[model samples]
Target: MNVAASIADFETLPRLQRARGAGRIAVGQIAGRTRLRTLFQEGCAKIRLPRPTGPAVEAVLINTSGGLTGGDVVEWQAEAQAGSRLSITTQACERIYRSSGGAAELTTRLRVAASAHIDWLPQETILFGQSRLERSLDIELEGDATLTALEAVLIGREAMGEAARDACLSDNWRIRRDGRLIHAEATRLTGADIERDASSLLAGCNAFATLVSIAPDAEARLEKLRPFLATLPHAGASAMGERLVLRFLAPTGIALRRSLQPAIAALSGAGSVPRLWTI
Candidate 1:
């Protein structure tokens, strides 16, 4: 079957960036100062923004029809100005349906300019067994810009007695500042690997997550969050100059979510957890 995709942008001035693919790849702009929106019946959708500032840009993704069944691909891009600040969020959790043939992929790109900031706080991603998924995030930033991101994955529904015994999952993320790579990570999970060594990969865990922050005060932020980070049964941290990486592994999805809340609040300085993630 041919892959399906779509792209949209919420720009308001010197022309925006937009691209989508559905068995075909297309690239274009939304034009700055123009507010644009599109509805996707099926296939992949992408949103791009350039030199954005002031009011934060928002996107609401709804799977109105139902869960994704076929091979669907989705991508998103957001770019901010030298002193702009932007926040990108999803209206709801992304649901991955059982794949009939190949897996689905979601790619996101974020670019921030000097002294700018971007917050990538999307809802959780639910995966069904027999499904395959690959998600990639690329962030490019200028000096003194800040980027805070979160990634959480649930293998299967415990209450439903559903387990991803034969499923496959892959996730990758990369962050660059001033054209220099600063952070990179990749995770791949399959049925055989999980069964063979559950402890090492899943650690008898059904869900896990990672939070990465890059800023001038990343070290201090890491120190402040040390107490909370220490509470995790399995956690790790590495810092240099203005960047800190944090990872968490839990036996249950609830546990993982519980541990992530305080850490995110402390680091992001948000009054409470993101509303979209309450579910």
Candidate 2:
């Protein structure tokens, strides 16, 4: 055997990278337009804003750490003042690498005042084989406030011929409106269970996304964006009461994004997504 032709597999001595950050923005009406009043940030999480245009304010969030692995902790928080209209998104998709120890944790907390509108449209989260990640999103909304949030997940990369069959993921969400619980959901998937029911639960797809909107006219937007969903395969769009949820599965990350852009644009009512999304 030629020694030079063989590669080393040393999982025991992997390099460790850790970072923590948080960001907050309080927006209020200035000359009848949304404007940031107070902003605070520390650690790995951040929020960047663009020049004022119209009454809606757009923000871009960043994680300077690039990616995360086991034993890492990151926190994100935001606030939307009453009558403020804010839309936020990540600079890029967040990636989680394989780990051998504790799982990475990402906790986000958001508050929306009465009559405020917030759009939490972070990009996707890609997981690598043997990766363990736990994330939770908690939102508190005042009465009559509107919220539009989207989350996407990619399990491994098909281009690399890799499968996240050994990864573990736990995603949780809790939402409250006017001090009353409105929606609470949790999804847990383990490596073994994923491999066992990949075909059934995942529907033979490698990536999936969900978009939720809560507003007085949330149900009406379903008909407005239904045509876009019709253009994609393995997609579902529905509305109940004051909430609309759009879910889709695709064989590749590109396809899922292609299917989501139009839906997000129409529902967010920004005429387009954040500037960093196209980049």
Per lDDT, the best of the predicted structures is 2
Tell me the tens digit of each residue's lDDT in model 1 across 1-279: 323322222232354222233221112123542232332223444333333333444444443434444466666666666555455556566777777776777777777777666677776677788878888999998888888888887777767887776667788998998889888889887777544246666676777788888888888888888887777787778778888888887766778788888877666524245555675
TM-score of each: 0.76, 0.88
- The global Cα lDDT (0 to 1) of model 1 is 0.66
Q: List the global CA lDDT of all models.
A: 0.66, 0.82
Residue 182 CA displacement from its true place in model 2, Å: 1.6
**lDDT by residue (tens digit), candidate 2, 127-239:** 99989999999999998898888889998987898878787889998888987888777767687665435665677677888888888887788988877778787888778
